[model samples]
Target: MAGSTLDESVTAFLKNHASNDAFEETDPVKASQKLFPEIAYTDTEKAELSQWLITASHVGSNTEDAAKAAERLSTLNTHLSSRTTLLGAKPSVADIALYQHLASVVSKWSAEERTGEQGYHHIVRHIDFVQNSPLFGLKLDEKVHIDADNVVFKIKPIDAKAEKERKKKEKEAAAAGAVASGATPTTLTGDQGAEGKKSKKDKVKDKAQAAGDAVASTVVGKPGAPEGAPTKKKEKKEKQPKPQKAAPVEKPLSPSLIDLRVGHILKATTHPNADSLYVSTIACGDPPGTDNTSEFEGQVVRTVCSGLNGLIPLEEMQNRKIVTVCNLKPVTMRGVKSCAMVLAASPRVAEGEDSHKGPVELVNPPADSKAGDRVYFEGWEGEPEGVLNPKKKVWETIQPGFTTTDALEVGFDVEAVPQLSGEGAEKKTGVGKLKTAAGLCSVSTLKGATVR
Candidate 1:
C-alpha cells in the first residue's frame, strides 16, 4: 500500500467487507498531476515552481540562507499578486510542493527570517489555503511551553589539592616516559619528590601545625615567644595634628578679562597658505561721529584670521558687523599673525549626522553700535587684561555660559558676569541683564542659533 511507485496497489483486507481500489504515487508532483489532472500548468510556471520548492526546502538552514529565501519569496509574491497559486486560477503540483516545504520550515525560522510571511501576503494566503484544505489531513501539534528553571546545569566543583596532585603526577609520568625512551631521569629534591607522594592525613596535620604557629606568634604571652615577649602595644602617640593649612581660595575670573568689542570687517581675503582659512582686516576702536578724544578715538584696523572659507561666502564677509575678543594673545597661523578672534555661532550637529560641515553665522551686534564700542553686561566690570594668558584658563571659566536663544541674541549668563562690587556688597541685586558700551547687545539675523 505504501510502495514507492505511481502504479503501486493500495490493498485493504477486512472481514465481510469489500476491498477498496486505490493507487499510490510516491512522487508528490506526479501524484498531484495524476490526482488533479484538470489543474494544467505552463512550462514557465513549472520552472518557477521548481525553483521555489528548492529554496523553501533549503531555507532556514542559517540566518543568511533564511534572509535570501525571504527576499526571493517576497519578490515573487509581488509579481504574482492577484493569482491564487504559482499558476493562475487553480492549485497545481507546484502549489502543493511549495506549501509542504514552507510549512515544514516556517515554524523553525527566527523572528527576523519570518518577516517574509508578512512581506509576501499572497504567498502567505496560498500557504494558509493549502494547509487547511480537506484533501490534506496534516495536524500540527499545539505550541509547547519551555520552563527556564527546569533546565539542568552540570558543573564540576574545583578541588585545589586534587589539581596540584594531578599536575605533579603528570610531570612524574612524563619523566618516566622519557627514561623508558633511553633518556636519563633528572634527580628531584626531597621537597619536589614528596609533593605528589604526601598522604592526605599528613597534609592536614601540617596545615593544623602551621595555623597553631601563626596563633602563638600573635599571643601576648606564649611559651615559645620571641625575645620581645608580651609585645608592648606602642601607645599611638595621640597624633598632635600639625596646624592644617587652609585651602587656597580660587580667585574669581574678572569679567573685564574678556575685552569684547564690536568690529567691522574692512577687507576680507583668503589666507595664502591655508585653504579653509580667511584673513581679514577688522576696524575696531571708535566709529565715525563719536568722541575723537578717547584712547581709541580713531578707527584701529586689526588683522584677524578665521576658518570660515567654506562656511560663509567671501562677498558676505565685507563690512559685516562681528563681535571680537580683542585681548586674546596674538598667534601666528600660516605665517600671518591673527590679532583678534572673531565670534560666530553654529547649530549643534544632531546625533549620527556628519559633523564636518554645517552653517556658521557671525554673531551680530546692534545696528547702531559703532566699531570699537566695548560689549559688557550691565553692573559687571573688571580691570580688562591687555592680553590673556593662554595657560591661565580665563576663557575656560566663562565659555560655558555662552549661549543663544531662538531670538538669535548672542550673550552669556548674567549670574556668571562678575559683579562690580566686592563680596561684602549686595550680591543678589542687579543680577541678570546683558549690556554693552553702546547699549544692550542682543539681536541677530540668524534665528534659533547657539553661539559656540
Candidate 2:
C-alpha cells in the first residue's frame, strides 16, 4: 500500500465482474436481495457489510463472533456454488461472485491475526485454495491494500487545504499577539503585503529569534525585584552570517540590433514519409485566399516546411497565415526547401499522448506585416533574405496560381496581402475576396481559398 501499490488490479477484477454477463442471474447483489428480501436494500446494508468485514479482520470479540462470520461466508459460498454449473469450471456467474468474497479475506489476513481465532485462519486457507486454482481465474499475487487511509498519495509536503488552514490560523495568532503588545495590528496593503509573503524560510527564522528573545528576558531579573531574587544573565549570542556570493551579471544587448516585426506563415503540408516535417509556402505579404475581401485583410502567404507533419494534417494548413522567425536563413530539409521560419504557439500534449511541439511567437506586433518579413526594432526597408545563412535555399521552385507544384506543406499560416490604412500604400490588384470559417476576409488571386 505504501509503495508500488496493487489496488488497480483488484479494482479491474471487480469492475469486470460487475459488467460481465457470466454473473447475470447469480450476481452477489441479486443473491443477497433474494435471500434477505425483508431486510430492505438500504444504504445501511452496504455500509454495514463493509464494516463487518473490516472489523472482523482488525479486531473482533472472542472466537465465537469470528466463527459466526466465517460460517456465514462459507454458507454463502456453498449457496453460490450450488446455483452455478461448475464450482471452479465453465467460469459461471457464481464463480465470479464467490471469488470477490474470497479475495477480500485474503487481502485482510495480516491484521486478522489479532482476532486469535482458528476460524480466521480457516477462511484465509479456503481463499488461498480458490485463488491458487487455475479454473477460478484468480491469482494470489493480485495484491490489495487493507491499511491505506489516505486516498491522495501526495509526494510533496504542500497540500492546498492544509496551507489555507495554516494561513488562517497564522493571521489570527498575529492579531492576538498585536493586541497583547498594546499595538495596532499591522495592516498590509499593496507592496507591504507583497513583501510580507516573500520568503517562508525567513519567517521561520524570525520566529526562532523571537523565541530566543523571550528565553533571554526570563533569564534577566527586573530592577525592582526582591534582593533575594538573584539574577544571572549570559551574553546574547548573534547568529553567524554566511558569506554571500555575488550573482553573475548578464550582458545587455544594444537596442539598435533588436528586430521587432510580425511575420506570417504562407503555406503548410506534412511530409509523406517522415512522422514529422511539414513543407510550406510563405509570402511576406500577399498570402493566397478565396477572393479579395477586407475581412481577409493583413494576412501573409509565406510557405513553411516544418516538423509538424503528424501532429497537424497538411490539408488543415492551407491559406492560413502564421507568425514566423522572420530572421532565420531558409534551409532545405528532406529535399524540400523553406524560406523564412514559420512561428506558431507551442504544442500542448496531454498525459499518455504524443507531444505537439511547434514554434513560438511574440505577444503583439504590427498588423500589416506578415511571415518572411523581418521585425526590426529600427532598420532599413527591403532587408536581405536568408538571415541564418543556411547551406541551401528553403524553396524548391515558385509555382503558379498558389498551387502545390511538388508536395505542399499542406497547412495554414499564409495568405495574400490586405489593404493598408497608412498613407502611400498601393491598392494591389489580381487578388480577390475569400470566405473562411471565421467569416469573409481578403485573399490572393494566385490560390483558391481552401480552408484547411
Candidate 3:
C-alpha cells in the first residue's frame, strides 16, 4: 500500500479526540494526557490546541497539521518512556500502541537518538509480547484474522534460522560479484560498493582536471598549454634604441618597520553625536609569529577617522587592513574624539560584476609606490622645521602649501619642477604631488622633516 494509506490507522486514532464522548473509545492521546498531563504539555504551552486538533482531524490531506500531529506524538512517546507506570506493572500492548503513535505520527526530529533507535527498541519489546499472547485481537502472529465475535488475533512465528541464511547468501553473492569484476570487496552495504566508489572517484578526477585547466589558462593564457606560455599573438620585432649613458644599479629598498605589521578593522559604527564621524576599532598584528609575541605586538589597536560615512558599508570594513596613520594627533569631532586617519584608495569604480563596463580595474601600481609605507623625501641634514601639535601628535606644515584642503586637491593638476636630487638640467614633474603653479608641486612627505 502507499505510505499515506499506511498512516490511515494512526490518523483515525488522533481523530477520536474531537468527538463528544472521547473516553468511550480507546483514545491514545487523551489516556496519556490524563495519566500525565504535566508531562503531556507544559504551563508555557497554550490551552487552545484546537487548531492542532482540527489539523489532526483532516491530517492525511492537511499539510500544516501533519507537522503538529508528529510533534504531539513525539512528546507523548517521551512521556511514556520516562514514566513506566503508564504501562502498568506489566507492560501492555496498549502502551506499545501509544508509543508507536508517536514514532509514526511525528516526522520531525527523525534522526534524533531519543525518537529513533531508543523509541523503536521500546516499542519492539511490547510488539514481541503482544505477538506471543493468545488474547483475541491481542496476538500478532503473521496473518491477522477476525473471529465471529468481531475480535482480532494474529499468528506470527519467529524465523531466526531462515533470516540468517538469507543474509549469508546476500553477502556471498556480493563478494563473488566483486571478485568477478576485479574490484576490491567491501562488507559495507548500500551504495558503498566498488562500482559506486569508482564512479565517485571518476567524478572527483574530472572536477580536479577542470579546475587545473582553469588555473593553467589564467597563468599561461590557454587551456592545456604549458605554464608561462604566452597566450597573445606576437607582433613583429622593432629595432631597439640605445642610451648615451648607463644609469647606476639601483639598491633594493628596505621594508618599513611600521608597515611590517598589518591591522584589520574589527567593527565600525557611526559616531552617536557626530554626523560625519565614525567610531571604528581595528586590530593589528603579524599573523602568528615566533614565541616572543612582541613581533605580533606590532599589531596594535587603533581607531580610524574616516569621511567614508555612508559611502562604505560598515560590514565591508571588517577584517580589511588599509594603511593607518598611527602617530597622528587625536582630534575631537562634534563631541567624540578620533585617534588616527585611515589610508584608503582614491574614489574609483565600485566592486561587482553587473556593470555595463567589464570587471572593475584596480588602480595601477605607481612606478615606485608601495601602499601603507611612509615616504621620506631627500633633505639637507639638519633639524627639520615644523611645529609638533602635542594634542594631535602630528607635524604641522611650515612650508608654503600644506593644509587639509591642499592635500585633498593634490591629484588635480600635474606640472614639471626642478629635480630635488640636484640633477642639474633634468626636470621631472612630481608624479604624486599637489601642483600649485604651472611647474610646482608638494609631496605627501616633507624633505627630511619629521612629524609626530
Best by lDDT: 1
Rank candidates, TM-score, best first. 1, 3, 2
> Against the unseen true structure, what C-alpha lDDT does each candidate score?
0.56, 0.38, 0.36
- Give the C-alpha miss distance for residue 344 in model 2, angstroms: 2.3
lDDT of 3 by residue, 1-452 (tens): 12112134533443432222323334334433433232333332212222223323443233546667556545544433323223322222234333334333333323232223343222222232233322112212242121213212211222335556988999999999888875654525566564345665796997899999988887779445566887877797997887669785432221111121123566778878766556777543211221111211223245555655654566766555444444444677676566555543332224663222221111111222222222222121112112223543123222111111233322211122121222546533332332211122222332321111
lDDT of 2 by residue, 28-118 (tens): 3343343323223346444443333333332322344776865665554333322221221122222333345456545655543412332
Which candidate gets the maximum TM-score versus the true structure?
Answer: 1
Worst 10 residues of 1 by lDDT: 10-19
Cα lDDT, model 2, residue 203? 70
Worst 10 residues of 3 by lDDT: 252-261
Assess candidate 3 and give its TM-score to the true structure.
0.24
Per-candidate TM equals 0.37, 0.22, 0.24
Sequence-dependent TM-score of model 1: 0.37
Work out candidate 2's RMSD over C-alphas. Answer: 27.7
Question: For residues 1-452, could you state the per-residue lDDT of candidate 1 as single tens digits?
Answer: 11222221111111111111112434434554564543455667656545554554443234456668657667766544535456554455445555544654554544333333354434544565445432222233422122223323311222345656988999999989988754432235566555535676987988899999889786845565477679766788787879989996555675556888888887899999999899988876521222111112122367789988999899989977888888878888999888888878776567897543757877777666656656664444544676777898777666545656555566565444344333545654333233553355554465544454
Q: Would you give me the overall lDDT of model 1?
A: 0.56
The local lDDT score (0 to 100) that residue 70 gets in candidate 1 is 59
